[model samples]
Target: MKFGYRIIFIVSVVIFFLNCAYYYPFFSDDSLISLRYTQRFIEGKGLNWNDGHPVEGYSNLFWILCTAILGKSGLDLIWAARILGLACSVGTIAVILNCFRKLHVKKEYVFFATLLFVTTPCISVWAIGGLEQPLYGFLLTLVLTEVLYIITSKSFRRIYLLSVWLGLLALTRPDGFLFTIITAGFLLFTYRQTKTNLLTITLAVVCIPTLFLLSQLAFRYTYYGELVPNTALVKVKITFHHILHGAFYTLSSFLGTFVLSFLGLYSLFILVIRKKDLFGFYLLLNIAAWISYITLVGGDIFPAYRHYYVVLIFFIFSIILGLKLNLPNWVHNKLQAGIAILIVINVFLQYNIPQNHRAVEERWEFKGMNLGSTLKNTFPDKTLIAVTAAGCIPYASELPTVDMMGLNDYYIPRHPPANFGTGILAHELGDADYVMTRNPDIVIFDVGNTPSFYIGEQLKKNKTFTKNFIKVTASDRDADYILFFNTYGNSTGIKRTDSELTIPGYLFRNNEDNAVLFTKKKLLKKMSINNRYEIILNDIPSKNWKIKNVLGKNLEVDTEIYQKNGQLTIIMIPKKELLLESLVLEGKD
Candidate 1:
């Protein structure tokens, strides 16, 4: 038994480490949101998205503190986040491994359960994804373990200790308060079993979490003038549209991992039949409540079922107990070998699954990192920028930012649309007029240099936005950048000449109302492989204008024009370079 335990523990650690390594360089952009807060907090800027402006954009308070401490020690906050997350994940494994032993689960079952826990791609992906999930997982698992010990031993001595862990759990994530409430309810539900010290037990279980909740609430109201984080306001809308989307999101996650989902659900069903079991009952409430809460919030936008990881931890113990309770005599005897085979299959499937959110995020991070570096180099430190990706670009640039999505904005959430929950989760709140009033020097619609969010779409139609900002492309040897520049704002002596029209990558002329765009044929061909470019000419004269495609017959070119909201938009598909002289727009009176 000792040898088997050691082997499984060592092997699981190695496998988890390797799994995290496989996901290297794939940091969650959202994680950087917390780290940015950490950076500000460490620099004495007061947990703010913009300096002197206090808004609790991050939900992970404990997470921010952990990284902030390390950042204060002069460590890179990004690395600090990654290391802390991974360590907490390893701690969770250690807790669960010790838990399996305490429950006296068989050696084979231990191997199966530990392997399943460690091999699940979601677990390891989040461990290094640089968010608070792993820390939340560790705290949650520790709390559950303590509860299991007390329930099995029928002891209330360590229940007070459990309260402190529960408090920490609540601080790790806003939704963690749900767990504390459930645990408090569990204690109350089992009151008859502990009739000796009712008042003491009640105080221990209830007062600690209540205090923590009150303290947090008081701090929020005092500092940011809100009872909850700004993120909650942006994300936690209770509309039918959001609920329906959340339902689909939760269903797809379960269906994606059908085998594991089946086992977890089956385990819960078995627990339901055993009406007298206290621990199993507790597990059922936690799982059901969490699933319901996740559904209510419109699920998560990130890939890899992150919101479900805590439930995954609970599923482990429940499934192990179910196997012991319900398997037939023969099946129980052969369960070890059968599960070993399943573990092998699972290892291959989880690591090699075609789920490629990591790849997509990696590309986005690369683009954001470069754009941020360019912005940092190009503009003054005080230049205010507005961005939809309130993560990588802002963190890297370290400039004042208008969080276009309201995740960190003070005004947008308070002034949300009447039908706020009808759009994308966390992206439904924005005021184009409010953002433009800030006079942001640069406005990035998305990380990938394209208009991709509700805010960007709204700004595109704003006449003030169209008249004051121009689409500018700047290129460094390291990266090509595209963003909207506010021409009405301070240019710092950077002049736009109609004769040269130089902006690193391309050249264009904005002379009077006759505009001409020029790009090297090679560059255009490289950028537009589909042989197309969409150009919107804003603030055009209200005259019948014709855009002539004069690139010559050496190659075919097509031009289509649409006039809307005083803007003439053209879709040009050219087989070669767009010559400045060839792109003449002549207006007929």
Candidate 2:
């Protein structure tokens, strides 16, 4: 292969590795939900729920396309989707390299630009994740590159291609409408002399989104009885404070990722001093304007830095302009080397950060466990599991569940709580045979105390059922305790011995008190619980325990234990909630 092709191939492999590493565990909650939606589509359940409520938390076009092509039980759908993203990211690199070569940019500048795109931490991380960002980044780069081409060539054919790309961009992200608006403004301002050609291009671009919106509107009206789904629930109230906060956050996030925003500023200063590179200036202005617009209209801004992927175009042109401008060879080379080093350091720091490592590890373990399979094994086939979302359970176990959050409008008739709390739980558990919570309580510190009080109060006040089920704690990696209230009579009082509960390759420990703990042996070193070690027994019922005082390992307790329904209920209540900073529960089956 030629040197350019070889460079492209290496960059492609690097992008693939970065994505795979980032999404190594593969399926995330977001991807799992998307896959479930696609499966529903395949099953002819319609886009809405069985009750005909409109499902619109997320856009379904991508899911529909994937399901149509890949079929059901192709369980590694996330990997497949990420591979598509990888292809787009690689395509973006090719387009950038080709655009530079065609513009007669310096070979060194072209290589550097390619490197910047390939190693960009923010872009590389998203390329393999289940989000639509990589696809958006690729299409945005391609569309903008074509826009530049159309400006220089002024060819109707190039303009037509631009229109096609604009359509694709809109399909990928709703924000693509902003791109369409900016393009229209650019054409009217720059191509007044060729009014007819500009009009034709603008019309072509407008028609694609116009048709798409109309079809969506029709679907919404038919299914949701409104033009948009969940619009009423999710409102955007933009204030000056919000805009200012968003602007500062967006800039800070961008700088945090690239560290090139500072360098880009210096390069801008150099360009202005030389009075050169008008095209580069225009591209930079366009990017800046779009970024400002995004900041102003911010909704979900946690991952705002991902928006800066569009700046790849501006970065490429600016570097080329720097090379072309009249300056001493040594000065140019030194600046280039410094900028490259800074970028490489930024990428390394961001990718290798301890928090990012933890996130990747956690996501992988959570997705790998197949919670659906566990639920099926633990409960009856006809059991109605009340989950925060219906994504994984339904697809994995073929169980009917009530989504507490009402995603995709699944529980429209039930009208579940807007938030996940007592209200949703109250409604869901009323009819549910068993309750399963990924995290039972919002506050992790006081789980035992709070849940016991809440459940006690609810049971006493409400006469929905006669029996108060016991809390069963199961050991899991992501959650130390899986607390559930089993209503079935098959709830055996038998507590299995440590030897009987042994799983090979997993650590099993049995304390003298018969408490069994399970964990991976490697993670034992990292586990610590400060100075205070307290164990709150879930079997406890009465809260009348008086602590004589903490004597070292054991606390003197004066309390009575009662056996109810052939089960031991012990209450080892703490004197104060804050006296103990950490509490470690020894797991026993």
Candidate 3:
């Protein structure tokens, strides 16, 4: 039996590794946010989001530190992050298996539970997401297992290990402090029964984690000049409106798949009632606190139940326990078969539930990367660009960017709109006037597309912005990139000029004098037929001008010239794609 169980465990681990390998290539956009910071730090820029501007935009401190250390060894930062995440994923699995073994869970039960955990998409997919969640999950599991061990064995010998893990967990994410508090409260509540040294236990449970928290706070204050991350200021809000949205986020993530959601909640309810099992009771409290905290903060923006990953193992363990306790003897005999069926159903749902959503994120990330590279090649290095999707575009472009949504900005988060929480979470903060003051050479709304957020709308209404910035289209074979370009900025490629062909009593202000000066320089994108150019020449007696298509005979173009009342009007009908050197009108006097 022992040999068979050993084989099962080894096989389960292999399957879990394969699951991670399958999802390893799909990179999350938000994960790039951390990598960008890592890249800057490795370049000796410190924790500054942009150059010389320190803002605690990222929530993962230790994850960035670990990745930066790997990066210092000349590893690619993206791969560094992914490799660290893979290590953490394996560590989490090993810790859980060890915990189960120490608890003396039945070999058959452990095998089934391990199968359920390894098959869940949330675990496998998120493990390779290049974010801190995998590390967070690993530390959380170690801490939870230690708590369970202490509760079951009635021994405080390894309590110090719990303290160290708790401290590390808190460093992984800001909300990790919640678990520290919960563990401390539980220890204090059960102090007298254990007859342990109260002061010693307090030092291990409370002091160690508090010291970790304090040190981070000191670093944050010293480096960024703030105690809390700017992200918390922008995103975290405690209100009835946010709680409702968070509840919806939570419900949608769970109810999006009925069987899995039902199993988790039902198992948790059963586990809560088993008061004799102190581990189950403690888990219930932790989950409740977590739910409330996530609810208050308006939930997460990323799909695949990002915020719920830390407690995923607890839910899986409870489901296994619930199945064992609630089912009849006949069903218990086929527990392994039942769990194997559940795993199959879950794999099917995983494709639709999170995998589809992940595909959408990947598409946007790729688009941002393409757009950023184009902008980098087209624009001057000093040319500043503003954007709403603050991750891939800015990182790929390596440009100084103004985060329109204020995730990495210093000004906007401090001055949000009055009715902030009523709109989309974290997207409610924007100051059009403030952004205009920066005078960005190129302003990209919704990540190089159209305007979709508050700042974009605000900028559209500003008269100064409308007068100064001209909306232009730069098209290539792949797609059309739209952005607002400053009309009067230095380093000129396109400029508005009066028609050299003159006629009396006629002004050539075609489309508010928005004319392109074909300078023969390679623009960001090829000029498509969508571009229009009209010029009216004044004081011209007759239509003596002949239109010339400089582009070779392969591409067709239609040009019209009309003369009325000694005024010559020329219109370049964009019938085909043209380069900057396509049109040249010569006079035949």
Clashes of each: 1, 4, 7
The all-Cα superposition gives candidate 2 an RMSD in Å to the true structure of 11.1
By TM-score, is 1 or 3 better?
3
TM-score of each: 0.83, 0.66, 0.84
Task: Give per-residue lDDT, candidate 3, residue 314.
Answer: 68
lDDT of each: 0.74, 0.48, 0.72
Over 221-313, each residue of candidate 2 has an lDDT whose tens digit, in order, gives: 786676555422322225465466557756665556454554455565566556554455556566777777656654233232555666655
Could you tell me which residue pairs clash in candidate 3? Answer: 502-538, 503-537, 503-538, 503-539, 503-540, 504-538, 504-539
The TM-score, computed over Cα atoms with residue i paired to residue i, of candidate 2 is 0.66
Query: Ranking under TM-score, best-scoring first?
Result: 3, 1, 2
Top-TM-score candidate index: 3
Model 2 misplacement above 4 A: 1-9, 15-19, 48-52, 71-75, 231-245, 264-290, 293-304, 311-336, 352-361, 364-369, 380-382, 389-398, 410-471, 476-589
List candidate 1 segments past 4 Å from native. Answer: 274-276, 327-333, 348-362, 491-589
In candidate 1, which residue pairs clash?
A: 521-577
Candidate 3 versus truth, CA RMSD in Å, comes to: 6.3
lDDT of 3 at 539: 51
